[model samples]
Target: MLPKIQHLLKASPAVTALIGAGTDPITDPVRVYRHGDAPQGVVRPYVTWSVPAGDVENTFDGADADFFRVHVDCWSDGDVEVEQLAKAVRAALEVEAYCAGYYADERNLETKRYRIGFAFDFILSRE
Candidate 1:
């Protein structure tokens, strides 16, 4: 599931522009991680995902549906950069699926980093 979502995001032309620019360390592809880990150093926005929510099976169809939450974290040395990345994330993902909720965590004083994030609640209909 994570791989599919990652591929989908990376494949989009708009998201691709942000990830493929290679203008700076932060301008590379958004690192999509299924584990709870992130790149260490000053870099661009990356993603880490948690174990998703429960699965709700649909007997009528070959797919199993679930209201899963994908937590996206945007990291950057500057706040605005991360915020923009987060917005890109929303634009990239929300347009593709049914987004039930959204949120943002801009910064943490202790970390001195920008972490604009969102909880994407979407259903996965698999065959």
Candidate 2:
């Protein structure tokens, strides 16, 4: 991973380093708390992602290194709900450019609530 990606992941309050841990291509989504302070009759969905390494490019002027990409998938109980949450998270992360995209909903055969899922990808690089 690029230094910036590593730095960000290492700095996450929800993450910890596991010594001698094997590196795998991570594409799994994790669930997290939406907010620390709860509101009256409101619940939020928040998720954090691990940084995954991508390709690297070397150049004479400077090495344009694309270290990795990080994605946080969020879900909410209504449409555009996940999108809004994702936007907030992106803003907090200071990633200026991203694509807000939607995907299929995952649910069990039993009880289900109105669920929405959206994702935004981040590309980290240094030249």
Candidate 3:
């Protein structure tokens, strides 16, 4: 699921233009990462995501779907840049997911980087 989400983000031209089309989408150090795994010295306007919460959808018949609550964060050196990147990320993922909520923009006083976060809900069929 993480790989699929990363592919969706990297494949969007709007997103790549802001972050970068790293040499390899799968191992791109600067474009995207699983939450808290970003490399040191990563460039600005990158993205991180994680499935912080999830569950199996069980029915009378059987469990037939997976529900995931994914959190995507865009980090940049400035507010405008982070917002734009967040917009792109939202657009890229909305095809298969819906926005569940938004996290308030945050500014880290120590690193001076701005971050905008969004939560998305994804349901995948187990069949």
Point to the candidate with the largest lDDT. 3
Q: Which stretches in model 1 have alpha-carbon errors above 4 Å?
A: 1-3, 21-30, 60-63
lDDT of every predicted structure (CA atoms): 0.62, 0.40, 0.83
Error of 1 at 67 (Å): 3.8
Name the candidate, 1 or 2, with the larger TM-score value: 1
Total clashing pairs for each candidate: 1, 0, 0
Over the stretch 78-125, how does candidate 1's per-residue lDDT look in tens digits? 777776766676787876555555555757678777776666766776
lDDT of 2 by residue, 1-127 (tens): 3224233333343321211111442332223323222234333343434333356667788856563444444445544554555445444444433544544355424424233344445554573
Q: Would you estimate the TM-scores of all the predictions?
A: 0.71, 0.42, 0.87
**TM-score between model 1 and native:** 0.71
> At residue 70, what lDDT does model 2 achieve?
46
lDDT, model 3 = 0.83
Q: Which candidate number has the best TM-score?
A: 3
lDDT of 3 by residue, 1-58 (tens): 3327878887898998988787775565447888645788887878888888998877
With candidate 1 superimposed using the best TM-score fit, by how many Å does residue 22's alpha carbon deviate from the native? 9.6
Instruction: Estimate the TM-score for candidate 3.
Output: 0.87
Of candidate 3, the 10-residue stretch with the lowest lDDT total is: 22-31
